[model samples]
Target: MVAGIQLRIGILTQREIPSESEGSEERAKVHVSINPFPSLIPSELSKMSTEKERETHVYLAKLAEQAERYEEMVESMKQVAKLDVELTVEERNLLSVGYKNVIGARRASWRIMSSIEQKEESKGNEHNVKLIKGYRQKVEDELSKICSDILTIIDKHLIPSSGSGEATVFYYKMKGDYFRYLAEFKTDQDRKEAAEQSLKGYEAASATANTELPSTHPIRLGLALNFSVFYYEIMNSPERACHLAKQAFDEAISELDTLSEESYKDSTLIMQLLRDNLTLWTSDLPEDGGEDNPKAEESSKSAEAQEH
Candidate 1:
């Protein structure tokens, strides 16, 4: 899937054999916290601002990393979109719908971002690009929901022995909020690739958990590790991305099944700690949103007008 996202057709859901009695629906009724984060932190937001400011750095780093991953994802999808025109009518239609928003949204979003980046020069109210922040936030929320749904299913794999009860529910929802946040990224082949790449990176970070460190909790490691893998798929890999994803999934799923109920422990509290730190800003971007954007738009429009 990583390589395919490299081509840009990311699959939102890969094939997974589900146990009929996994209790996936019940998991939804339960709630789990998510990592404390926003799509991105204001570059100027200082950690010294408050006692809670310290953890802000880590969250920003993670969110920045995720943003970069999505930028790469956009490139991969563009590649596939370029090829879509040659596809059959039905296939082209499907492909077009998948990229419909992202294709335009990225450009629109970039306009806002680039303008904001030049904040010193653009003092005009409409020229301030931050106004678009709300739309991006909406997109992020939608993505989080998608990720939450899938993770719920995947979380069943985290429970030790699948004992029919609330513990199973907690395991499923331990990081439920993550789904919506993760899903916020580009969700096609590109997303799959992104997830796969991220998974590998996290897995590499967690190598010591299983054997070398008996005190470490493998399930927790597995969850963090697996979340990154899902990012790999966003890179636009095809179905084959699953192979790269399988290792992490296996570790997580296996840990859920084999570990005895008595053996379960909060081996690593990192996930929970991070999960509670979500500090999203539903607030507006500064006024003066991207007025300077008109010049570029006008120039492009004139060029298109001439070409037409």
Candidate 2:
């Protein structure tokens, strides 16, 4: 005699069968269907190989950068660095330096924006303040993480290799920017320390650029402009600011004059910004002390008006 049998099935669950009937002593048979959704669970999904994870993060980072979501890009790149442990020393150093730049810029942007937000709050701009609060909070949280990660990358990767000239210059420049922003948004002690670091970084970049880059290099002019700002705004040293700005302004004007209008088009913004800085710093100098450059000042004002 044959015994009755029962079977049960459920989605993504094991099949169940009733035991054989006692009198007949018949055997029970059970079979499981293939899992239609194999990667449903977190564990299964996370089983992606390390290389794949690194590639995914790298792709995400590129997308984030294109979207101008710099903090997200930086974080994703950091993940790529963490997972790409098998990369060559040069590759790892390059990746770490690039990661540091993104993190530094993100942190600096947050610090600058937060400072502006505080100013807005002080001015009783409640509506704008409310609109930016969520964004400000998000950036603040990311900044805390970025600060720690930047130091780790520098200490572990950059310092070990001593970096190439270009990489080292970029590293110090970004480091200066990070500290400068930190000074502006944080405590007085940070201000002092950050000023010191900013000055040191700019000076190092300047020294490196003298050997590694041309006198007319855009990087050189940019470094000077930044250094001038650090002196004028952060250190409250107008004399030093004027000195650096004047040097940068002269170099930029000479460079600008040499380029064709078409070639100059690419550098218009940088030129305009350099002129603006020169005007700003010179105007702040003691009347007799500042070198008067009426032409440059007028040009900068015209550029400003056109931009508006």
Candidate 3:
């Protein structure tokens, strides 16, 4: 007779193991089985399989952005972008935008803090000034690195094709913004180089927009306004600034007449802003100058009256 022992494993059925007796006729039996852990049920297996489908990083990024936690938002967005799964073009674009926004915010913060540090230094608060300086340097270095990474992303993923008009326009516009911030915060030589780079970017964006979009498009008008500001404030060219401002204002007014009432209402604030810019830029021009340009004189008169 063979002695047998029964064994139960996990959720599997029980099986018997036979043991040899002293008699020569006794036989031994072998059992083969596979049993998953008792703790892993159907629901748990489903959850595990669906892990890649979870957009938790994206959700966290949006939440962090809403909370103004820019650094955390950047990290979350990076995690989302680096996932093992392939991303859609739209998703990649979103990641790029998130990085751009965070980098811009970081640059702006550093500028503000640097200004504060300068004020503190002027007040003879060496201790606080030193702390602020150190913090600002760290932020500047980190933001510079992030800016370079974003530029790479723009070049490689966002607008890999030079013929992609819309994407190229967006990329150059962002490049303009990045260089403008760099110009504002860098040393004299670096500032000049950054300013030149900024102008090049703005010009490229403007050219691409003019070629691909309508003259009265919001993007064209916005680009004109930005160029005006750049010329007036950064380049110290008041005449060019006034000319671009006038162009933007005229285009906005012309576009306004073609829109429906609802659309007109939606654009009213932008139109008002354009008008304000016209007035501001006109006032910035030399009172006794531009006598040879009749159009400029007429525009100046119109802007002065429109402000009321």
Per-model clash counts, in order, read: 62, 0, 0
TM-score of 2: 0.56
Q: Order of all candidates by lDDT, from best down to worst?
A: 3, 2, 1
lDDT by residue (tens digit), candidate 2, 35-154: 445656655645556667877777776677578776676677667555525443334443544555555566556756777788889999998888778787777666656665675665
lDDT of residue 90 for candidate 3: 44
Residue pairs with backbone atoms closer than 3 Å in model 2 (clashes): none
Q: Which scores greater on TM-score, model 1 or model 2?
A: 2
TM-score of 3: 0.61
Candidate 1's clash total is 62
Per-residue lDDT, model 1, residue 238, is: 18
**TM-score, every prediction:** 0.22, 0.56, 0.61
Q: Give model 1's TM-score versus the native structure.
A: 0.22
Off by over 4 Å in 1: 1-183, 186-204, 210-221, 228-232, 238-241, 248-258, 263-308
Kindly give the stretch of ten consecutive residues in candidate 1 with the minimal lDDT sum: 299-308
| lDDT tens readout by residue for model 1, 34-80 | 32344536442343243233234334433533565433343333333
Task: Kindly report which residue stretches of model 3 are placed more than 4 angstroms away from their true locations once superposed.
Answer: 1-64, 75-101, 121-131, 161-164, 259-269, 279-283, 290-308
* Candidate 1, RMSD to the unseen true structure: 28.3
Q: Each candidate: what lDDT? A: 0.34, 0.59, 0.63
Q: Using lDDT as the measure, name the better of candidate 1 and candidate 2.
A: 2
What CA RMSD would candidate 3 show?
A: 9.5
Worst 10 residues of 2 by lDDT: 299-308
